[model samples]
Target chain A: MIIGALGPEGSYSEKAVQIWILRHRLDSVGIQYFADIEDAFLAVIQKKSDLSIVPIENSIEGSVGVTLDLLHENGVEIVGEIVVKIEHCLLSKGGPEKIKVILSHPQGLAQCRHFLKKYFPEAELRSTGSTSHAARLAGEFEEMAAIASPEAAECYRLKVLLPNIQDRKQNYTRFIALRAAGKNTAEQVFEQVLCDTEEKTNRPENSSHSAFKTSIIVYLEKDRPGALYEILGAFAKNKINLTRIESRPSKKELGDYHFYIDFEGHISDAIIKETLKDIKTKTDTLKILGSYPAFKA
Target chain B: MIIGALGPEGSYSEKAVQIWILRHRLDSVGIQYFADIEDAFLAVIQKKSDLSIVPIENSIEGSVGVTLDLLHENGVEIVGEIVVKIEHCLLSKGGPEKIKVILSHPQGLAQCRHFLKKYFPEAELRSTGSTSHAARLAGEFEEMAAIASPEAAECYRLKVLLPNIQDRKQNYTRFIALRAAGKNTAEQVFEQVLCDTEEKTNRPENSSHSAFKTSIIVYLEKDRPGALYEILGAFAKNKINLTRIESRPSKKELGDYHFYIDFEGHISDAIIKETLKDIKTKTDTLKILGSYPAFKA
Candidate 1:
């Protein structure tokens, strides 16, 4: 089996995949690395990989816009989820006193703004493509330091100068495992994997008591005062608890938007089905992304 | 008067301020540039500038998370808004063929991904703090190109290699002018500015016919199935049109969020006040970020 994820081998996406692998106790899996989230997602869509793991949202930085946009534009189903705790570290080849420049992804630098301002006030900051990429580059220069995960420090053979340097301590990133839609064999395999994990963790066998989440996108036909309110009313009337709600630009106009909503229920549930049917009537377009077991970290 | 905006002089935020100045025919206004959005916002909070202009949302990129988070954290009020059309251009010290590297802010590079892939497929893409900064760096290297505004090309003494290179032509950035809350004198001055523009545009004298937008942030006391639905219900019940609604991480947990909402009525409107009063009862925290005249274009 081949799994695709954003890479240089030490990305947080890779960490999510590792957790998924450990949960399922999978073996004989090959990992494919893509430079960007969209490329990784497309690998699954094009059948280049059986599944893809990509970051959906970060606790501090908010949603990954490209990932959300790709999910909306492509025909893919989210089969699993993994929540990885983010702990940014400062890595370098030499001591902190030797560092004159810091390198990182824009988000890494932004998340550790306070730490950098206080400690390395005079150091120049440069942006890179990824945290792991910064780690790789930091390995070549003694005057350079990187803000990345500890895994990246190990992969690049760099020393951890400081740990947990992010501005907020409760940072996390949620990743989703995606597979091509209408793949029955893959669906069966995923279900078996879930069942094995449930048995190992001693979770309840009843489907009604299991934690599951369904995601969908809604676009209104026209701009009205209460259009979104009415659409959301469908979920409210069904007593479905929403886990997340976000709006993305529709690309046609400034004020126009398409909403992505996540709620607590499986699509197979009768109430969930009815709620979606009612929402469809109120919206111009409604695309069901998928239903998956909720991550319990 | 002094205005604070994100800048190296030719940024989109500067363009928004220029448009605001032109609309009001205001002179003797000096602009103070800050390296980041937070600094510009702080300048207003600290009374270092009379007003601060910052980008709140983009037609293609969605909301600026830092700007939204700061508004929710700080006590500043949005007194005005400006909409600036984004037209990205390829700037270089020499011809396009001489370009080996392309520099831009991350959003600029992402927005023009397709154009670069098709034309300059092998050029190395580098990220900078701002588009204007990229233009400045490009001016020093003949082999470097920048994805920035035409104004940046002129400011940096570079030639425009190509115009309108962004993937989307309808791109626009919306900027908000902020002031310290409870500054009644500034509020009156802003109202007079709006009235002058309205008369110049031959708009109706009736305040009821004027287009204004109110922004607010809501944090639910707890996560429940119908909590948000009830808050939004207030607007729907009052028949107030929502211009935008977005969720930002509250920075407490992965699932916890704060909703930023914009609607079609001013805070002083009787119906709007009643709707807010009802919403206040439904949520633990509701902050009014002030109301301003909506940008016409």
Candidate 2:
């Protein structure tokens, strides 16, 4: 089996796929790297990989707009969700004091902000394309340090100058494994790779845990008063729980937005269908991104 | 009079303040450049700048999360709003054939995505801290080009190789002028700088345009089903229109978010006051982020 992710081999996206592979016990998968999330997502559409893993959002960095936008644009389904805790390490060739420059991806730079300011206040900060790339650069420079995962640091053979320096230790990023809309990637994973996750399916046949989440993209016909309120009222009257809600520009006009909303329960449920039907009447468009088992934060 | 904005002299934030100053007819204002939004926001708190212009959102880039976060953290009031159209220019010392590298801020690179792919696909794209900084670098390097504002290109004396290359021509960014809360800077501006803004004020004595907008920060007591729906219901029932709604993490933990919502109507209205009273009951905490007249998009 093959999987697609963002990389030059040591990226956090690569790390996320590694974690997902390990969790599913799919140890024999090949990893293909892409330049960006859209490229990785495109790999799935192009059938280069059976599935692709890309970050949807970070707890600290907010939503990964590219991923959200790609999912909105393409006919892809989020089959699986994984939350990876982001741990930033200070890596260098020598001691921390020897570092005069700190390099990292913007998020990496932001996550370890407090630790960097207190220890490397005088160091020049540079935002690189990826933490692994920063690690590779830091490994070649004697006066440079990197803020990245220990995995990326090890890949570049750099010493860990400091471990877990993220401002808030609970910082995590949510990644979604996406595949072509019609493919049942989740069924394949549960039946062949991992049976425990099967405990999570809300297929009505699954006997174990049954927590499912449905994601929807909503577009109202007009910017009228109570337009969004009426839409929310549909879900509220039905007692559905919303996990997340965000507005993104429709890219059509200045004030137009498509609300990306996630809520509890599978789309197959009667109430969920009723909610969508009502929302359709009130909206210009409604897209069901997918329904997948909910993952713990 | 003095104004604060994010800058090193040629930044877009500086351009925003300049436009605000020009529109308000406050020609004698001194512009103080700050390292970041917090520094500029802090300037207002410290009474260093009577007003600070900071970006709130962009048409394509979405929300400026840092500015949103700082506004949430500080006791700041948004006194005025401005929308700046982003026009990206291809700048270089030599012609397009001589350029092998492209430099710009991430947003600048993203805005002109199509133009770069078509014209400079072979150029190595480097993300700089700001478009002005990119212009400065492009000016010094004969083999590099930059995507930045025309003003910044002129500042560095770089040639405009191409103009208005953004993927979308209607791209704009919204900036808000902030001051310390409880101090109606608009009232003072009307008395001293700009009287028209005062006429638009919600103050009971004001006899001009009454259209107003109110922004609020809401933190739900718990992640209960329909908590947000109930809050939205309050406004919907009152016929208030929401201009924007975005959720940012509270920085305390994952899954905890503070919803920053902007809606039409003045807080001084009895209906607006009643809506807040209802929201207060449904929320763990509520903060009024202050309001100014709605700016045309």
Best by lDDT: 1
| DockQ each | 0.62, 0.51
Q: Write the per-residue lDDT of candidate 2 for residues B182-256, one digit (tens) a residue.
A: 555322322322222333334545523236777889988556878888899998988888888888877776567
Real A-B contacts recovered, model 2: 0.50
Deviation from native of the Cα of residue B40 in model 2, angstroms? 2.3
Residue pair clashes in candidate 1: none
* Top of the candidates by TM-score: 1
Query: In candidate 2 chain A, where is summed lDDT lowest over 10 consecutive residues?
Result: A186-195
Model 2: CAPRI class: medium
Q: lDDT tens digits, residues A25-57, model 2?
A: 996899998765667888988998889998887
- Position B253, candidate 1: lDDT: 85
lDDT of each: 0.83, 0.77
Evaluate residue B239 in candidate 1 and report its C-alpha lDDT on the 0 to 100 scale: 83
A64-123 per-residue lDDT for model 1 (tens digits): 888888888888988889999999999999999999889887678877877987898778
Candidate 1, lDDT over the whole model: 0.83
TM-score of the second chain in candidate 2:
0.85
lDDT of 1 by residue, B1-297 (tens): 999988888998899889989998999999998876878888987988889999888887788877998898888889889998999999999998899989887678877867987898667677666788889889999999999999999999999989999878999888999988754432333343434431222222466623988888999855667888888899888788888899998889898999999888766555775777678678888777877788897
The positional error of residue A203 in candidate 2, measured at the CA in angstroms, is: 2.5
